[model samples]
Target: MKKINKLILMVMITATAVISSCQKLDMPPTNIFTPDIIFGSEAGVKSFLATIYRALPIEDFKYRPDQGFKVGANDWENFYNSASVTGEQVGPFGGMDIGGGFGYWPYKDIRNVNTLIEELPKYANKLGEAKVKSLLGEAHFLRAYFYFGLAKRYGGVPILTEVQDPGAPLESLQVHRDKEEATWDFIGAELDLGYQMMDETNETGRANKYVAAALKSRAMLYAGSIAKYGSVNFVDGLARAQGIVGIPADKANQYFTKAFDAAKLLDGHYSLYDKNSDKVQNYIDLFLKGDSPENIFIKQYSIVSGSAHSWDATMSPRYMTANALSRSYPTLDFVQRWGALSVTNTDGTPKRFNNRAELMEGLEPRLLATVYFPGATLRGLTFDMQRGIYPSFSGTAAAEVAKQPNTRSYILAGDTKTLYQGKMVIGFTGPWTGGDELTRTGFYVRKYVDAAKPIATVDLNRSEQPWIDLRYAEVLLNKAEAAMELGNASDALTAINLIRVRAGATVYNSIDIDKIRNERGMELAFENHYYWDLKRWRNADLVLNNTRFKGLMPYYVFSENKYIFLAEPELMQRNYNFDKRFYYEPIPGGELGKNPNLYPNNPNY
Candidate 1:
C-alpha cells in the first residue's frame, strides 16, 4: 500500500490549532511564537507547507457546486454537482435550478503562499539548499495551482507574486487583473519552474515533478481551449483593454503543444490501471483502490486523523445509504451518448436492444461501470426500478380494450407481482415523486463509490476513501484532445484508443474533435470533468440551451413475463439555460466593493 506520510497527519492535527491560536488575540501572546521563531525550524516550515496544502482547492470528494471547495456538513442538502449542470446527470429532487457561480477568491491562502515563498530563503541555512529548493518548488506549484483555479473560473485575475505588508497603501494593494493570456502564461511558467526545481523522487502525498507536469497539462489545455473557442465580445472595452478575459486565437496551438508535451513526460511513469479481468469491476476498483498506479495525484483521507468525506453516504442508492437519499442521478442523454459496446462497428453506432434485460447489452463497459441502471445490483441489493406494471388483462373486459399509455396503463396498486402463487413481488425503485430518497431519473451514480464501505450504517464525514484528482486516464485524454486540436488525428486516435480498449469499447478508425470529446465525456463522466470540458470546448450553450435531459422508465409486462423499457423526457421539468456570459463566472461582489479597480466583473454580472 502507498503510505500517506506522517507529516501530512501532523499538519492536519497541528496547523488548525496553531493558526487559530495565533489570531485569537490582537497583541502577541506569550504562548505564540513570532514569525522568526516559526520559520527558523524545519518542522515549522513543514507545518506551514502542510497548511498551504490543506488550503489548496483540489476539488476533491467534498467539492460541491454551491459550496466551492470546502463543504459544510449541511451542504449535502444542496447535492447537485458538476454532473448535475452538465447533461450527464440530474439530482434526486429534479433538475438543479441554482444559479451557476464559483465564488473562489482564496486571497488569504495566496497571501500565505506568497509569505512562504518570500520567507523560505531565510531558512536556507537550517534546511539544506536542495531541500530549500524543493520547498520553493512546492510553494511555486501551489501558487500556480491557485491562479489556475481562478483563471479557469473567472479568466484573468490579480496575480499576487509576493507577500504584501499589512500596512500597504490601498492603491498599492488594489492590483488590477492581468490579461487572460498573461495570467495563463504566468501559470505555465510557474509550473515549469516548479518542475525544473523539484526532485524526480518524492514521498507520496507530496508534490513531485510529475504532479507539476500533470497540472501543467491540465492548465495549458484549458488555456488552449479558451484561446481557440471562447468569445471575446462578452466583456466591455475596459475589461478587454486590461486583458482581463480574452486570449488571442493564434496562441491556441502553442498552449495545446505545451499540454501535449507535459502529458507525454508521464508516459513511462503511469498507465491505466487494468488489474481485474472483469472490466466493469476493474473500472469501479480504479476509484476504490487508492494504491493504483493510475492515480497520478490524489487528496487522501484518514478516519484516524479526522479527515474524511461523506461521498458514499450521500451518493449511494437509497436503500444502501444511511441517509437513504440517492443524489446525482445519471441522465439518459449520457447513457444514450455512451453508444454501443460492439467493437466491430467503425462508425461508433449505438446497438439496438429488443428487451429490457438486453437494454445494457452492447453498451460500453465504462457506462455500465459508471451508472447503476435499472435492475443493477449495488451493495448486495438489486435495484428493481420498475416505473409501473402492465395490468393483468387476460380475462377482464378492461384488458379487452386497447392498451392505455404506459404511464396510465400500469398500476402501482402494490408491489410488482408475477404469476407464481407464493412468490415474492419486487417493489419499484421509481421515477416516482413525493419523497426524498426516490430517484427522479431511472439511474443512480456508481463511480467514486466505496463499495467496501458499509453505507447503511455510515454517517457524515466518515468515508475515508481517497479522491483521485489527477490520473493517467485523464492525462491520456488530455494528450488526445491536444493532439486532435493540433490537427494530428492519427496520434490523437492512438492515444484515445488506449483509453477505449481499456474501457472495453470499440476503437475508432477515423476520429474528429467531436468524437474525441465524446470519448472523454464517457471515460471521465461524473469525475467533475464534463462540465468544465463542455465549458472549455464552447459547447455548453449548444448542448444545454433550454434543454431538459432525458431518462428511461422500465415497466414489467406481466402477460409477457418480461420487462419493457421506454426512453422519454425525464419525470421532472428540468430547465437549463447557459447564458453566453456564464462562460466567465462573475467576480464576487464583496471583492469588487473592496477594490473598485477589480471592476467590470465578467460581463453579465
Candidate 2:
C-alpha cells in the first residue's frame, strides 16, 4: 500500500502539469517541464513563488524539540529531559544528545533554497529582466533566511550557492563547511541583495523589503545578543569579540537600531489583537483566535485544501477530541514556568507563587482563560473532575470520554497518573489514542483546539483557527527586551506595560524586571518557547538542574519547595552533565557516514 501510495503521488505530479499563464513558451514541450522552462513563464513563476511561501508548520512547535523530551518520545529529548542520556564523543550514540532540533529544519531549508538559487537565474534574460529579477530577489531573501536559521543553530554550515547537477553532484556534494565568519558575511551580502531586489507592497510572501529588513534586524539582534552575552561561542575564557563569533555590543545596538527602523516602517500595518469580546478565554483568544490584529506573518494553513495533517487530531482529546490522535502534551515544567510569572509583586517586591496550585489559583486570570481545567464550570463547560471526566481537549463536552479513575488509562501508552497538569488544566488526557499507557510529564494543549469542528478527519483545512507566528504583542515584548538589554528602560517600560494594561495583568503596573520576564513566559506559554528562552536568558542551569528526568517516569518532581508534582525515584535520568558541546547538535550520523570530507561531524562528535 505504501508503494502504491508513492506511485500515485508520482503519477499525480506528472499528470497535473502546470502551464505558463503569462507568456508563450519558446522552448519545446519537453523543456516546459524542466526546472528552468517551467519557472520561465509568469504564471509558472508566480506559482513557484507561492509554493515557496506555502510550506509551513501546522503543529505549534516545529523548531522546538523541548516537548519531545517532555513527551519522552525519542533519545534526543530523553537526553535533554532526563539529563541522563550521556556521552560527549561519538561512538554509537553521541550527536545532538542535547538538542537536535537545530540540525533538522535549517539544513532542510538550505537544500530547498539552494535549489531555488540554482534554477531561477538561468531564465533571467529569456523571461524578461523585471520578472526574472523579482523571482531571483525572492530566492536571495529566502537564502538569507535559511542562512539565518543555520547561523542560529550551528555557528556555521556548508554554504552552497548553487544547485548541484545530479550527474556531477559528487564534487559539490562533499564540499567542506564554511567558516562561521564567512558564512554570516555571505548571508549579510544575500540580505543586501534581497533588500534591493524585492519590493514590499508589490511582493507577496516571498521576501519583501520590509521582511528582509525585519529579518536583517532579527539576525543582527540575535547575533548581537549572542556576542554581547559572551554566550556566542567560547574558547576557555577569552570572549572573542572577533569575526563570526558574536556581534560586539556596538554592533548589537546597530542591529537593534536597524531592527527598530525596519519595524518603524511597518508600524502602520500591525497592532496587538485585542478583541477579547468573549473575555472568558482571553489568553487563548489573543493567540489562537487568528482574527486578532496581533498576528503579522502566520504560515497559513488551509486544512481541507492543503497537504498537511489537520490539527483536529492533535489538539482534541480522544473520544471528545475530533480524532483519536494523541495529544501533544505540554509538561508540568512548562506549567510551572508560567506560575513563575506571579513571582513579581506590583509593589516592587517578588510575590513568588512557586507552587503549581498557588500559581494556578493566584495566576493572572489570563492563564485560566487559555486552559480547559478539568471540572471547570465556566459558561462553556461541564464535567466531573473527581470522575476523571472534564472538558475535552477539544473544549466541547459532546466528544469527551468518561472513565472511572481507579480503572486507569487515557487511551494511549502514556500513563494517566502523570496527569499532574492535564488533570488540573483542560481536564483531559493528552488527547492521545495510539497505544494505551499515555506516558507524559504534562497535559494536552487547550490554546487552539476549538469546540466547533471537534472531530478528526483526513481533511487538513480548518479556517476556525489560524496559527500566530509573530504578533504585534510579540513585537512589543521583543522591542521591550531589546530596549531593556540596550539600556533604554523607559521605552522598555512603555512596551511592556502595553500588554499588562490590556490584559489587566495585576502583577505589574509598569515594567518591573521580574514582572516583564514573567509576563512573557505566562502570556507566551506553550506557543513553544520555554526551553530556548531559558537558554537565552542564561537561566538553564538553575531550571535544567531541576528539570532532569529519572529512570523511565515521564514526570519530574522539583524539590518539595520547587514544584507540586514530583518525580518518582525510579524515573530514568538519561544524561547527567551539561557538557558545553551539548549546546549545538552535530550533523546527523547518517550524513557523516556518506562523506567524511563534509567534515562530517560536529567538532565534539
Candidate 3:
C-alpha cells in the first residue's frame, strides 16, 4: 500500500495556522494515472481519491478563510512591507505573499479525475460502473472546486484537463489558462455534470445535488460581483460576469431550491453537536468528532495513537505541551475579530460589546461553540487566565518581520495580551518566564479536537475523524445567498434561520440580505470562506484590512521587548465598505511564466 506523507502534509497544513495562508494544502503525485491503478477496484480508487478530501487544510482553523477571517492592523502592514500592489486593499493583501513553494494545487487532483473521465468508458457496464460514476462525479466536483479556487485567487486560471508532463517544455505546454469568465463557466458546467452523476443519498460529507447547487450559488455570486465591478488591465472585462446570466435567474433559483431541499432532506438526519448544550461547551470538540451532520465531507486525523495530520496538535496553544514548540498562535486582532464580548445577532448582525462577561451575559448557544473568553464562567471553573504565567521569547523567531523590529520579553495578560483591544481573558503573552505561547496567543478554538476522548499519554483517539473541509451548513448559506441575490429575501431568511436556530443564535435576529450576510459571516467564520466571500461581495479590502485590523496586540507586551502599533491612525483607517478591484487577485508568476499569452494579469497585481 502507498503510505501517505502524513508528516509532510501535517507540516504543510501547520504552516497555515501559524501564518495566515488561507489556501488549503494540496498534495499530488507526479506519476501519470491509469484506470488500472486508479478506479479498477474500490480500494485502489478509494486510496487514490480519498487524499483530495483528506489533504484539505480545514481542521487547522487559523486560515480556513471563512467570513470571520481577520488580519491584524500592524500585521497587514507587515504583509505590505513584503509585496507590491495597488487599488483597494483587502485585509491580507497589503503585501500578501504569493508564488510560494506550497499552494492548494487543484490541477494535481483534477488531473487524476480527468484521467478517469477520459478512460472510464472502458469499464462501461462493469461492476465498478456504479462506483466509477459516483467517483467520476466526485472528480468533476473536485475539479470544479479547484477551478473555483483558481478563479477566486487569480481571477481565472488555465483549466488543464490532463496532467502536465514534468519534462514538457514551456512552449509545448499548449494550453493557456482560461479567463475568469470561461473558467467559471467551465467550473459551473463541470459541477453540473458531477451533480447529474452523483447519488444524492450518499454520505453527508460526500458531494451530492446539494453540494453542486451550493457551489453554483457561490460561483454565481462571485461572477455577479466581478462583472459588476470591473478593474484594471482589462478593457472589456466588465462583461465577464456574463456567466451569471448564462445560469438563468430561474436556473439559479432551481439550483438553490435543490440545495435547500437536499439540506432539508438531511435535516434531522444530522443535528447540531451541542454537548452539555451549555454556552461553555468547547468549540473545538465539534470538528474533532468524525461525521457530525454539520460536516458535509471530512478528512480524518489523529494524534500519536492513530494516524492524523497534525492539524489539531500543531494549532493547539503552547500551554498544551503538544503545541508549545509548534504553536498556532492567533494574531491579537484575529481574537478581537472573533469577539469574546458578542457576535452578530442570530440574523447575522453585529453589535458593540466590550468585555467577555458582557458577551456571555446572554449570548446564544452556537456563538459560544467557536470561541470563549476568560470571564465567561463554565463548569464552575470560570476559565481564568493568569497574566504572569504565559511565556516570552527574544530571538530570531520573528526574523523576517516586514515593518516592525523583532524580539522582546512578553508577559501574559489576563486575556488582553493576544487581543488587547480589551477583553477579560489572558492567554500566552510570549516565549518567556513560564510563558506558554501556543495557548497564550490563542485563547480557544473549540470547533474541533475532542476533549471527551480519554486523554492518552500523548495522543487522543476515540475522537472522530475531522469532517474538515465542506459542510451542509455552507450549502444552506449558499442557498440563502443566491436566493437573496435572485430577489427572494424571504427564502434567504428561511435558509439563514435554519443555521441560526441550530446554533441557538436566532432570538431577536431579523431576516434580510444584509442580515443573512452577517449571519453567514459569523456562522462560517474560520471555515476558510472569508477571502472568497469578500471577493464575491467585492469587499476584501474594506473588511479585511480596514475596520477589522486592530493593529498589534499590546496587552502581552513586557518591559523587555519594545513593540507598539506605529502608525496607529493609519492602521485604524479600515474600509468596511468594499471596492471594485478588490474582487480579483493578480495572476500567479509561475503560470504567467508558462503562458503570458492568455493569462493577462489583473492590474491589481
Q: TM-scores of the models, in the given order?
A: 0.87, 0.66, 0.64
Per-residue lDDT tens digits of candidate 2, residues 83-169?
112211001122223455534444544555565656666777768777666667777877776677566556556788765444556
Candidate 1's C-alpha runs over 4 A off are 1-32, 75-78, 92-100, 232-237, 340-357, 392-407, 413-428
Which candidate ranks first by TM-score, i.e. highest? 1
Task: Please give the ranking of all candidate structures by TM-score, highest first, separated by commas.
Answer: 1, 2, 3
Q: In model 2, what is the error at residue 247, expressed in angstroms?
A: 6.0
Better by TM-score, candidate 3 or 1: 1
| Count of backbone clashes, every candidate in sequence | 2, 47, 52
Task: Give Cα distance to truth, residue 567, candidate 2, Å.
Answer: 12
- Give a tens-digit lDDT track for model 3, residues 1-605: 11122211322211111111112222233232345544455544544554555433332332322211122321111112110121111223333332221234456556655655665655555536777777778778777876776666566567787656546686767565555566767877887777788876554235565456556656656655555433322323432343311222334344444334434444454455556455445234565555355555554433332333333343233334232233332233443432443333344323323432443566555556554444443223343433331132232322212324223343334233544334222433222224433333223444444444322321322233454455667767776776676677776787777676666664325466677776776676655565456655545555444343322222222332222211111122333433444454445467557566644455434
Candidate 1: residue pairs that collide: 179-243, 341-362
* TM-score of decoy 2: 0.66
lDDT of 1 by residue, 1-605 (tens): 01112212222224431111001101121221345545666666655666676677776666776667764555444245678877788764233343346688988778777777777787788887888899889788889988988898888898888766556688998888888899999999999988988987565346788888989999999999988887555445556666788888899999999999999988998889999989898998888777788877777665655566777776765566666556667788888777522311233222233444466666678888898777677667777776665544222322322245452555543334433333223344555544445566788777887776665555666776667888899999899999999999988999999998899888889989888888888888888888788788887777877889877766565666666555556666578777776777888888999988888777767
Query: Candidate 2 — worst ten consecutive residues by lDDT sum?
Result: 15-24
RMSD per prediction, one decimal? 7.0, 10.8, 11.0
